[model samples]
Target: MEFLLYKVHGSMNTFFMLEGEEREDYEEMTLKLAALDPGIDGLLVVLPSQVADAKMRVINRDGSEASMCGNGLRCVARYVCERDGVEEAVIETMKASLHVKKEQPQGDGIAMYAVEISPVSFQMADLPMAYGGETEWKLKPLPFVSEEIPFTAVAVPNPHLIGIVPDEYQSNPAHQQKWAEFFNGPNEYFTDGVNVSYATKVEGGIFVKTFERGVGFTNACGTAMTASALVSCLAGLVPYGEVAVYNPGGMVKCSVEKNGSSFRLRLTGNATYLAKQQFKWEGTSSESGLELAEELQEQALYEKFIEQTSAVTNRFVS
Candidate 1:
């Protein structure tokens, strides 16, 4: 069937697209897609209505679905806006309401979008970490090699653990690997799974590397960035204003504000436009005509995707 496709990178280098419906055998499909082409990174199952209205389901290359994505949301916001010709939009993901606004152009001929992420909550119940009882607060320290880094567990729509890395940990791959292993370990105490971030204090901004739960070692993560910024502020790494996060994909700006016990993070970044073309899938069958029918269904699905996102944009513009 026809599906909306995009080569999204940054945060993690996943070449993914949005499918209208859930696959019959998600695991097999995921493996197939990853093997379909060398550039096939991962797949994301999105509820255009739900995410734009409430939340989106993130399906990884391994066919495992997760709650949210930071960089992916920025790409989605831009996709919905440009495809529908809108300016401002509010997208709902599994976590919170994402307030997206179109921004001035950048150098790469790609449009920029500003997505306001949800507040940060350290409550174990909010993170819903499986191991811990629903408590008023949750915090911990992880030792990476010889360095012990203190981190706060926060949810920026998605769950995350943010820690500041000293200069020693910044260049040590072994430290990063150890940190990743600890997060993946059972003792970490996140029941619902968590994304991990390591930050280094730079002159102008902070450098971050993330180990996303569903996806590993990504360049940048929007939610994680927001979470990191707020955690940094709480830990006195940066001030409570606009925080620039340097990721491998590129740099994005996030603004934070205290909201009672929580904080709000606003993220800004560029969304690049790849080629647009028709996708045709062929199945070997005695009923060649049925294959044609399947193709028609796919095309219809793609049209529906376009139409739904278009409606979302129209509502914002109109």
Candidate 2:
């Protein structure tokens, strides 16, 4: 069977989008394709949704399914927009049905999209974290950390444990290495594994690095960034407004909303289309491999988008 592979990236976290109804062995195929060279963080299977414009199934490289992926959602929004000739779309994820709107281009070629992330919660039962009988959960230092580093658990429909560290620590390679180790290591509180993000306040907003649960150190984590912004606001680091979130890959803007004790977030960033190619699907099993019929030709465009976005981000924040 012929399949179109659209390689897209949002804030440097890349994913492959496959349109059409999934084949019986699509999960295995997704795993194989995501494991390809240069690597991909996950696969997005776009299928028709009765409740929305389109339904997205997020499959990580390890073949595990995720409830939601903010970066992936942006890419899917752009894809559906271009294919359907529409400016907005409602995408139904595993957890929530989200509203995505196409925004003005970042520059000449870059496409910008904003997605509404909601149903925010901080309950330990929602993160499904193991906790003793506690009425409410708040930010506290992890038991494993040597120093007193406080962490807040927030679920933007995706579980994230956020720790705000010093800005200098974010730039240190050793600190990043150690942080990743701790995230992946065994922990009593998070038995099911949770996405971990370390944030540091910057002039404009916050800089974050994420060690994702299924996917390790990615260039960026959209929900993690949102979670960081929320935590920063709660900790009195930044106010509830437009917050500039920078990751190793690039920068995205997050708008935080707080009403009484509830919160909501909107993420705006580039939904960059990198390449499109035709591939031949041979079988329906895990061992079934895909044969690439063509090469990816949009490397220059991808690089240009990265350069231009980074420049804009640096000039604004620096």
Candidate 3:
């Protein structure tokens, strides 16, 4: 069967979106489709939903299904709303029924959307990290990652371990890769593995470097940025309000609100459509018949927008 596929990105966290029911070979399909685009981080398979506008199931390049993908949610939000001719829609994720709405146009052909990231939990059990008990892992010592840098575990439906480091204390990629690999592979801490991020303070914003669980050193990780923003606010590194988060790929805006003992986060960013393709799937062992249908100029404009911004220059943690 032939179907139209969309190549989309949120804060440059690229994904391939297809509108159809999921296939049994989704895991194998994810691997094959991801190889098609070097920049692709995951595959967003849109499925019909009885509870919301659509259901988004994220299959990472490594063929692992994600409970929730903040970046992918924005791209899925834009796709569903545009397809249904609406401005607002709710997307059913694996963990929650997230509310997503179209935001005012940010120009340069950028499709902006705001997604609600909630059911926030700090309990080690929620992340299911083998940290003894259900204690809220706050700014405490994590000797495994770094004894000097304190870490916090957050579950915005997606488990993440965040660390806020100073400019001079930031680590290199090889260093980050070493620790992230341990926790993600077969470690005593995260048996299921967790998304790791190291955030740094800038003049007026924050820079986040992430090692996603299934996807390694990506240009950006939406949930990681959201988790970084929230952790920054909790640690008082930044004010508890709107924050500008910059990453290697691009930048995103996060609004953090204090809610009792926890917090609520709203992520607003670009959902740029890169191109369209027509593909047919035959079997798990075969190649996905992908042909370029059309391409869009939004990616170039997005790069121009990023170039004109100061976030690119403010990147500290490399």
Candidate 4:
């Protein structure tokens, strides 16, 4: 069968989109494809949604499936919008149905899209944590990573454990090493494990680095950024409003608002299409063959995206 391969990036977290049938070996395919690109965070399978305009299945590099991915949704939004010639669409994910709209373009061929991420909760049960009483868990230190570092657990329909650290530690190699250990280490606190974020307050907003569950370290984590902003507001560091979030990948704007006892979030960022290629599926097993066409790389478009992002941010990218 014929499949269109698109390398899409949202806030620097790259994902390979395979637009085709829902095969039984998708898990295997995801593992294979993700292994081919060290920069790739995961693989996204695009399928027709029964409840919304389109359905996206997020498969991590480890062959595990994520309930939802904010960044992936934005990229899929762009894909569907361009295909359907529409500005708005509702995408069905494993956890919730998300509404996405194409906003003003960020750069040449770089479109900005905003997605509504909702059904926010802070209860320990929602995060599926083993500890915690009736009160929401916030600013509590866990032994898994560090006894001194306090963490807030929140689920923006996707479990995240956010830790607000000093500005110096935001990009510190030692802290990044600890983050990597905590997520990959054998920890009892986060029974099923959680996406971990270390955030630091910056001049305009906050900068965050994330070690995602099943994906290890990524250039950026959209949901983690949103969760970090929410934690920032709750901690009184920032007001409940639009917060600019910068990561190693790039920048994204998040709007965090409190409604009643809960909070709602909206994420706005670039949905950049880097390249498109053709892949041929051979068989149905894990060992099944898949061949990529020789002309798979779209270097021009990829370079343009990198150049535009660099120019707009004026941030040096190695």
TM-score of each model, in listed order: 0.77, 0.88, 0.95, 0.87
Q: Between prediction 2 and prediction 4, which has the larger TM-score?
A: 2
What would you estimate as the lDDT of candidate 1?
A: 0.61
Candidate 3: which pairs clash? none
Give the residue spans of candidate 3 off by over 4 A: 132-134, 168-171, 285-287, 310-318
Q: Candidate 4 residues 30-119, lDDT tens each?
A: 776765566788888889878999898998888888888889889988889888999999988888888999998755546789998876
- By summed lDDT, the worst window of 10 consecutive residues in model 2 runs over 309-318
> What are the lDDT scores of the predictions, listed in order?
0.61, 0.78, 0.85, 0.78
Cα error, candidate 3, residue 46 (Å): 1.3
Model 2 residue 216 lDDT? 88
Clashing pairs in model 2, backbone N/Cα/C closer than 3 A: none
**Candidate 3 local lDDT, 28-116, one digit each (tens):** 87787877666789899889999998999999999999999989999999999999999999999998999999998775567799999
For model 2, the stretches where C-alpha displacement exceeds 4 angstroms are 22-24, 173-187, 284-318
Best by TM-score: 3
- Candidate 2 per-residue lDDT, tens place, 1-318, comes to 778888888987988888989567667777668655347888888999999999999887777787888888999999898889999999999888999999988755578899988779888778766656653456687565535667887778888888888755565546555655665568566666688788887777777888887888888888898888889888888999988888878888898988898887999988887777665666644444455535454445556656744643453233
Worst 10 contiguous positions by lDDT, candidate 4: 309-318
Off by over 4 Å in 4: 132-135, 183-185, 283-318
Residue 222, candidate 4: Cα error in Å is: 0.8
Better of 2 and 3 by lDDT: 3
